[model samples]
Target: MDNIFKSAMRGALFFAAACLLLWGIVPEWKSVCAGLLLGAFASFMNALLLRRRVEIVGQAMANRGMRKMGLGLGSRIAMVLCVAMVAYKYPETFNLPATLAASMVMPFILLVSAFLHHKRH
Candidate 1:
């Protein structure tokens, strides 16, 4: 429950930051909302998958050797490749530029926030 709440909050924060930044640059409310929604969905999906992957890897690593860890990494790589292929095939629907921009913005804001939080602490 705590993990789920944390993930939701993180997604919301990323969505808000990307929307605010892009709104300042684009000056279009529709575009800003679109970007925010995209960012939030992407971040939430990524976080959920990442958390699951980490948990699986941790469990596997406890009983298995390093040689057996390739499956987890391979799955992640395959997932990335699949997403890339879909993006490539349906670029019009995907809106690669906006997607990439939102994707980059979320991580950038998260990193900056982490740095600031660390500095303050």
Candidate 2:
């Protein structure tokens, strides 16, 4: 979890700088930046939510016989849905492809972190 957080933060900083550079150089890319930033944010939020959900479920399982998964996964999905919808609606500003691609940043971060950790060990 700590590693996840660290990687997410590092990826976010890298994305932020890339977004800022895009925002400055290309006017059209502003939309790309918007979508990319939003997607990156969703990735970060996902990591945190997943960690929290795991903790909650673990606690519930220890306390009770059969506990339901009470994570607000619906709301989380809705959040990403809302963003995707907005980006889709305004294709000129927020391109769908870029947004979708950017959403995978966290996975990339995780992979890189894992690889580095493995190599170090």
Candidate 3:
């Protein structure tokens, strides 16, 4: 429960920071809000899903003696395909620049989550 709260707070902070940055650059409150909300949601979802998938792959690697490099390559390819599909399906909602920004924000989300998790431990 504590860990979950910490993670949520971390995600919120990341979202706010990203929003502020976007607002500063774009100077449009509505667009900035939309972009920030969508970007933060995407980043959070990506982190959660990717973490689960990576854990499964890690377990498989441990059991089968698989190479980490192959896992890394596969994950990268999967991410690209997933992003492409999203972009294709929702072009209006996700343009190239917004998608790029959202992608860039994901690592910050993950880093915040990790930091909170580590602090709890």
Error of 1 at 66 (Å): 8.4
Candidate 1 residue lDDT tens string, 1-121: 3344464557567567766676667754554355444545565455456657777777778978563344554654454454445555665444445544544453454555566556776
Which digits, one per residue and each the tens of the lDDT, describe model 3 over residues 1-121?
Answer: 3465457647666666767677678754545355445555555555565666677677878899664444544664466556656665776555545555665576765566677777878
lDDT of 2 by residue, 1-121 (tens): 5775686578677877898789889997888898887777777777667667877788888998676656377866766777788789998788777777776677678777777766777
lDDT of each: 0.54, 0.76, 0.60
What lDDT does candidate 3 reach at residue 6? 56
Arrange candidates, best lDDT first: 2, 3, 1
In model 2, residue pairs whose N, Cα or C atoms come closer than 3 Å (at least 3 residues apart or on different chains), thus clashing, are none
How good is model 1 by TM-score?
0.49
Task: Using lDDT as the measure, name the better of candidate 1 and candidate 2.
Answer: 2
Model 2, residue 37: what's the lDDT? Answer: 79
- Looking at model 1, residue 60 earns an lDDT score of 76
Give the C-alpha lDDT of model 1. 0.54
Residue 10's lDDT in candidate 2: 84
